[model samples]
Target chain A: MITSPKVETKNLNLYYTENQVLHDVNITIAEKKVTALIGPSGCGKSTLLRCFNRLNELIVGTRIEGEILLDGKNIYQNGMDVVDIRRRVGLIFQKPNPFPKSIYDNIAFGLKIGGMKNKSRISEIAEKSLIDTGLWEEVKDRLHTSALDLSGGQQQRLCIARALAIEPEVILMDEPTSALDPAATFKIEELVTQLKNSYTIIIVTHNMQQAGRVSDFTGFLYLGKLIEFGNTNILFTRPKEKLTENYISGRFG
Target chain B: MNIRNITDKFFHYFFLVSGVSAIGILFAIFVMLAMNGLQTFTDVSISQFFLSTRWNPSAFGEPSYGILSLVVSSIMVTLGAMVIAVPLGIGTAAYLSEIAPPFLRETLKPVVEILAGIPSVVVGFFGIVFLGPLIADVFNLTSGLNALNGSILLAIMALPTIVSVSEDAIRSVPKDFKEASYALGVNRWLTLVKITLPAASSGIVAAVMLGIGRAIGETMTVLMATGNALQMPGSFFDSVRTMTANIAIELGEVPFGTTHYFGLFAVGLVLFFMSLAVNLTAEHFTKKYRRYRT
Candidate 1:
């Protein structure tokens, strides 16, 4: 089955002041699938993920050329509200970044700011979001406690639930498990696979095994260019490009 | 011993002596205040000294050692200064940390620092010459020197300390928390009030307490600007005398060791405890905030 792209980029280019970071890249991210971007340090994979939500523009003197479309609408067009576009897309950072607030309020922050006013309804959505991320049972008894008191793994999951509470259509994870232990990393990978069934998932990772384990499609980025992109199994086993094969085979990163 | 080793040992003991002498001076001052004030404490019951509102220590017939009015004026002036300084300080800090462009922040920060560098006597002089008359004219008062003038001057003096320390606290809030708030699509103002301010709450609290300390212990400005009235202040517009001003006014040329002289020492002791309490509270809050910073 051929699925239409949920997000598409056309000849996308990015620059920080005078320095170019991404160049002439075209890619399509399909709906309801996990697409992983793999690259070395400063390879621009994280920068590309930030582009989806226009987060890159936060830095002073950042300039973007070409179009990034979400569901066939140009996100960068004049008159398109940046805040509204950001609400439709959620982002999870490399480290667990829960607010210095109670566990329940952490999830409810998005709901409240997004204008969901009913008290009971906000709690209802917060509870559901926690359950969806498999954190409801562990945290149910102490939802009023500070979120920082949670274990590192639990904090990361709480962050995921925080993103999910807004019910965004697309979720972006940028090395979400890089700070967790092996066991915690495995649990997050499991959650990402489960999350793929409902929301379009785009992840940027440095761990090859994580990309292979959780992703359906993979793109290997090198020096700000997409070297190869294809089915995950084929990309790992029989890469089409020399750089992709070298990277997957543990050659120079 | 070799010259280097001898020099190192000499320097180490020199530093140790200097540190010990500084602490010894503080202990000596405390002992002096207690010894000198002890006579006054016995002459007038402690309750009478603290509770009596009429503070006439040099009356021809009978002297009254009441300091309740001084305490009340000190508190009123400190609270009034906090009312003016706290919001202005924190608002300027937030603007410097989050809103202002780099060039403007750089330009304005040093201006606040210079305000702090101006001597308290000079500030008191400014109050006497400018702020006092202006306030008197505006309120149609008999004289310009009053609690209101004192508070306005002290607020200006406290601003630099409060704004600089608070700016550091707000800026020290981790980048990740801000990014997370922005990722949630929350606006800049909401994120500032809800996330950054709460995270920096303890530091901001410590800053305010320290500012209060500066306002309460300040002697020159309050003494010059408050008209040194011994009567209890009926309102902010009325001329008032704070504890600092009382000690300052009586410390000079009162016959040494007379009950009146000892009474001033007792007031000095009270001032000491007040500043000590403020410093201790500030330290407690700063330590509490330090734990979460990591």
Candidate 2:
């Protein structure tokens, strides 16, 4: 299938102090499609996902040498607004990290901090996002209660609703299901499939079956190198690299 | 049925005895203070002791025994100390916990602990020699010793507690919360103000209440620096005497069984209750903070 790239990284290399974490690599994320990065631990898949929005730049000893482009413009270029880049590209973490606040405030915090002040409009956006994530019915009655009170699945969905409220062009998920149970993981995976119709999503996962089930494109990484990249269906059944096949076939992580 | 069971029971009773003894000692102290302090009311009327502003127990003609002024003075100095300490302490804590490198934090934390260990009398002397004169010069007052001077000294004494406790609270706010806020396009400053600080607010409040308790209970510094004036303080700059200072000043010289000595014990009782109230607030907030954590 042919598609335009929403985000691209070229000759990207990242180092933490003296240790290299991601080698020179290039990849394109298709517009409005879910791309899954699958690898074992320490493979730099999460690092790559963070790079799309420059989240890695905050770490103390990290250094990136290469161009990451959002909409064909180098995000690494001089005079880029990091806050603007982050606003456009939202991220969710492995753990469900709702602020110790109400469910309504969880969704409204992003908008309010971004300078949205109109009360009715903020409520409208909050309700719309919650409905979009299929959490409105479950949480609507208790929007004023602490978000930390939600179950793992509901909390993860609340986080998704939180991201949606901000209206980002792309969303990044860093092992978002790793901390959740199987049922919660299924809910998140299904949400990912549904989300791709509107926003470009880049997900990092260690579970091969999860990548196959949810993603249109899959990139298999091994030991800081992108060993295989292509359609998810082909990558799962017909991987060209031996390491990718070995990892996917359960021989070794 | 076995020696193991006997050992377990022995230790359990031992710890139970230890715990019960602590409460027993506290209760005994309260009873003793109440018994001695209540005796003063027999000689001096309760309304005069509590409501009057004059406190000259050694007046030549008619000795007065009011404590309202002393209470007001203590409150003034404590409030003034808190005004200076809370912001500075919380800011230093935030910097240490959120921004300071590991090496600096490690070095500075021990330094703060040492600051707490400095003898209060020595700190009080420093207040007399340095801070009191500086304040008098700055504010163009006749005397160097004042409530502001005592407040400054007490704020220095309270910094270690406030800084360490607030730092622990801020640091305990999960890193995940900060990361989530940052991912939503908020910067570190905004995240700290909005999410991190609010999340840690109960703990920070507990720290502040503990600091207030420390300032109110402090005797030597206020005794030396606050000029020990008997009048009710009108502002932070006024010379004043705290209840702790009053008790310390009069107790050593007063006759053991006289109304003056018993009156001092009554003041001690009031001071105890004041600190108890502050400490109970701190404990309550600490419990509330723990609830948020889990």
Residue-level lDDT tens digits of model 1 in B80-162:
99999999999999999999999999999999888999999999999999999999899998798998999999999999989
- TM-score (all chains, Cα) for each model: 0.98, 0.95
Which 10 consecutive residues of model 2 chain A have the lowest summed lDDT? A1-10
Candidate 2 residue lDDT tens string, A83-175: 889889999988899999999999999999999999999999999999988899998999999999999888988998998999999999998
Model 1 DockQ (Cα-based): 0.81
Off by over 4 Å in 1: none
Clashing pairs in 1: none
Q: Score candidate 1 by TM-score against the native.
A: 0.98
Task: Please give, for every candidate in the order listed, the TM-score of chain B alone compared with the true chain B.
Answer: 0.97, 0.94
